[model samples]
Target: ITLPLSAPGIAFSLVLVFLLAIGELSVPSFLRYPVLPVLSFTQFAASYNFGAATAAAVPLAALALLGVLIESALLQNRVFTFRSIGRGLLISLGRWNPIAAAIFGLLTVALVIFPLSALFADAFSLTTLHDAMQRAGASIVRSVIYSAIAATILMALGFLLAQLTRDRGQRLVNFLTLALFAIPGTVLSIGLVRLWNSPMTWFIYTTPALLILGYTAQYCAVTTRLSLAGFFLIPKTFDEAARLSGASWTQRLFRIFVPLSNRTLVCAWLAAYILCLRDVPIALMTASPGGDPLPARILTLMANGAPPMIASLCLIMAIASLIPLVILARVIPSRGITG
Candidate 1:
């Protein structure tokens, strides 16, 4: 019975995972998986064949657009009753519980625990972590700064977009974000390069602004969606009462809507920041020649880097991602998790 209502969430999740898989760069490149993103990057960066790169990305571009359209359709002019999840009765697992637990435990060990253990052992050796810090300190700091700026911009825009589309989804904004996100990062970087490469726009192209723009364009979809969920939780009556008393839209937004949705706002910012921090192709393509972010630095070191050194670099990346993720976990209410 719950499955019927779950269909929308399940479909969105499937599309989300599909887009992530298609946009992924590191694992596919490292494992030599011949994925679309890798092929597109190679065509654009290595071969200098823009036409071929664009052609290779057509399928994923369509796929990302389809996901956005489906998302809009799911949300279009509808009041989401996510709380209705409680209406269904739980099915008892009986004897299958222990078997299910064992399967999950083994999978967790194999997929998560074992790999992390290996990475920890290799990364924490004498001088490895220190060396990684020394080598990538500037890059890590730069990543954080860039991620911060981009996240702030994204958060503001996401809130505004969420407000604009409170009743209906914003088609153009959604489409633009999907284009930047679904299309090859390399292709987007190249487009940015061409757009702002000239002396007139040197300030943007030569600085971290270019990287921030790429991050904003790609992740706007994500932050907006997250923000919209928070927006939905707000009572329209609150806004109405404030307006009747002559509270400006800005005042109500900052004083009422914002505080009520503070948790989700933070979640949106954190999500955008992490996405920006971990991105590879865009940073690699747009970063200053000597000032690559940690992810970009890892790729650079991968060719001739020692095992310990690479592991340490990767460990630093993991830690950077983990701190925010931990906070995200905490900020989420237990009821939210159960729901």
Candidate 2:
């Protein structure tokens, strides 16, 4: 009846409100109805129950406290002095310690090369490799497209936002951008789910669009930071020079600012793409039940007791993700690209 009586906006808002209410109500229902009964049953089984769980927790807490105290004592005794530790690490890795240096060099090579090699091997394995490839074939292509679209949207938004704000307001914008860095991916996922879990937002929740949205919200700040840095690097003089040359604002940006910041823009795009590729927590949480990105699929495989397959899948993804990073590293010069 309410659905029929309402307009689109009202109906959508009502549906969201209903879901929020359901989520809110489920908490107390779980605690009072289920949790209390379970607690009572456990208490009866223990027989001497003076809240045995709570009592057991106390000893564990004391042991944790003792460990912390010992750590503090060792730290206070200069066992972890910053300068001394730094000097020791430097000496250990330096040529003065040839064996240590050799060990360190081998470790570094293993760290860098082993993962890629393992992934390459796994990607070619007879049984699992074929299955993972088939599973991820179209989805990998779609994820790349989705990532590119999201990065473009983010770059555009960041540029517009930077252009609209004054120097003083930019500080405030920067603070807000930095603030997002503190929000964990899971928290952002919950917020996205809550915001879009409505009949009207069914498309977002059901499609890969929600994954894109989650990635955008989490990494908008990174895009803003990269673009803003690029923006600053393009001198105010360039804008003035363009204006005096009879170029409009759009022309000035297209011909001057953007051309000058091409490297930064590419770097930003690379950062966004790499982040989107590796983003496991948010992707896992937001992915549609039917379709998931490579990272999420790897995680799902792991959870379903397929370690060898997961390892193989992970190796393939690591290689795939590395291709962009390697390209970006090669393309971006140490010196800035100026118009």
Candidate 3:
């Protein structure tokens, strides 16, 4: 569960290295000078200085407060106001919990809102936003095309595989699907690279076709699983009825299964498309110079210390990722696919 959730982030980080490498080319001359070299030194010095000051101030403040309370008690010659102190402490503690919870909530909100705010803010900037939009526009278009083409191929294969198998081989097919899910994008990329590094596959390796192949391989199981689920939802009666009515397997599949499973088919395609769009590790590892995806492009900005541009690109990518999700949402409502 954790693996699936973290896979995207891990893949994002891996691709980010490549993005930064590209962004580093744009570093300003002044920042490249002595000021840049001293950054680490300044950070280290500030940490130690702040730590010492905080340490000294906390203890000193504590002692001063203790002394003040003691003096006040002594001046009144009242050894202690136990009841009053206890009531005040209880009141303070009662107030503190809600305040702390509010603060915690605010912090969490800020963690989410701030970065997004910064991204929007940066996108409004004339120069960086223009550059990001121009670059991202091209990359997004290419990636979408690549993903769509790959997903279509994967969906066809998955549908055929699902149609061919029955109870006896279903377990084996499912195990193979699960195996594909378990394989990391990096490992898949390596396998692809090895397979295509040969002379006969040289043209395939260097083209956008290679990236498509990698995506199809990675996401084929997703399509299979979705198609399988959709297939199961379809009654066996449809097939049997079609056969009794003099329909061949192909005609039955086309006339009944395909029409009835339209929603599932669309969903499977959408799922594969989303997975392909978000794919970073395999794309990054296997992408030829011509086939970089949007995620790969955003990482380039992050690596260059261009947080503003990176934020902007991230926001755009977030929206891009959500498109399929939005479609899925709209789709489910109409299809009666409920939780």
Candidate 4:
């Protein structure tokens, strides 16, 4: 019973870490490691062998698909059933309150405060920040614009997929999204290149549009899950009432569903934006010669740049990632919402 109840949360955590890890390029590339994604990149970039690259990616793609199947099997019996918040019993940590508080304080200081302190210390100078910005300003803007576009696209796609899966038993869409999420960025990039690096699709293949598609493909599963969870909170009666009142599908969707799903949409958009913003592998592989995103630019510069400048660039990226959280903090309180 407990396992079934906790399955979704566990699955979400596992998928999150797995996706992040599998798509990563810098650490493995820098360490000269033979991780799947890095190996694929090497085959393509170092040897310029598209066929070899595709062949190298086959096993990685198969493993990712296998993982997705395992995830589905584990959660097959875990239905989406939410209970009223008021139904749960609350335990007051009266005796352990101080101890719990102390533990949290220590963790916050160690995990959050300490790392941020070092970043600030290394990247504190205004001159360095300005220089960093001046040097990679275009890439910075590209990262933001591309990520925002990708996030918007993901939210739209997520809502449609979530609605389909929820009301029509089209669970295959959900499974496909999960499978796509499991694909490493390098493997996906190879497929994207093969599909588009031709005369027929030349108009799009060499453009930033390719990176946008990669972002959408890589992160749409997150938004889909978020949207599905949001759909669960909305009672079926609302839709039924709207239909009875002669609301068309479009009317019911915009008039009822969209209004109720604002928070979920916001959360999904933010999550997707952050994922795209921090991504490097997808951009590295898909971005045109001069269209590299900020993270990719940083990785490239790290090879020859000064330590302080690199640190500054990294700090800027960290701050950029926090912008969504800061927006949520301000907007949620202003709207009288609580966590």
Q: Highest lDDT: give the candidate number.
A: 4
User: What is the per-residue lDDT of model 4 for residues 48-135, given as tens digits with 9 covering 90 to 100?
Assistant: 9888888888987887887788777777724353233544665568999999999999999999999888888988998888888888
lDDT of 2 by residue, 240-279 (tens): 8778889997887788777777776777787788878777
- Best-to-worst ranking by lDDT: 4, 1, 3, 2
For TM-score, the strongest prediction is 1
lDDT value, residue 213 of candidate 2: 87
Whole-model lDDT, model 3 = 0.63
> Per-model C-alpha lDDT, please?
0.79, 0.60, 0.63, 0.82
Q: In model 2, which regions exceed 4 Å deviation? A: 1-106, 109-123, 244-247, 337-339
Stretches off by above 4 angstroms in model 4 are 1-12, 15-19, 77-112, 328-339
Every candidate's CA RMSD: 2.9, 16.7, 19.9, 3.5
lDDT score of residue 147 within candidate 1: 86
In order of TM-score, best first, we have 1, 4, 2, 3
Task: Please write out the lDDT profile of model 3 over residues 1-339, one tens digit for every residue.
Answer: 666755644553444343222212113222443222123222223353433433333433343334333333333311111011222223345768998989989997798777667778776677876777776778888778888898899888888887887434655665455444444454455557667978898899988878888888767766776676677666788788888899998898888778877777777788888888877756665678856888667655465646667766777777777899899767755443211
Lowest lDDT 10-residue stretch of candidate 2: 77-86
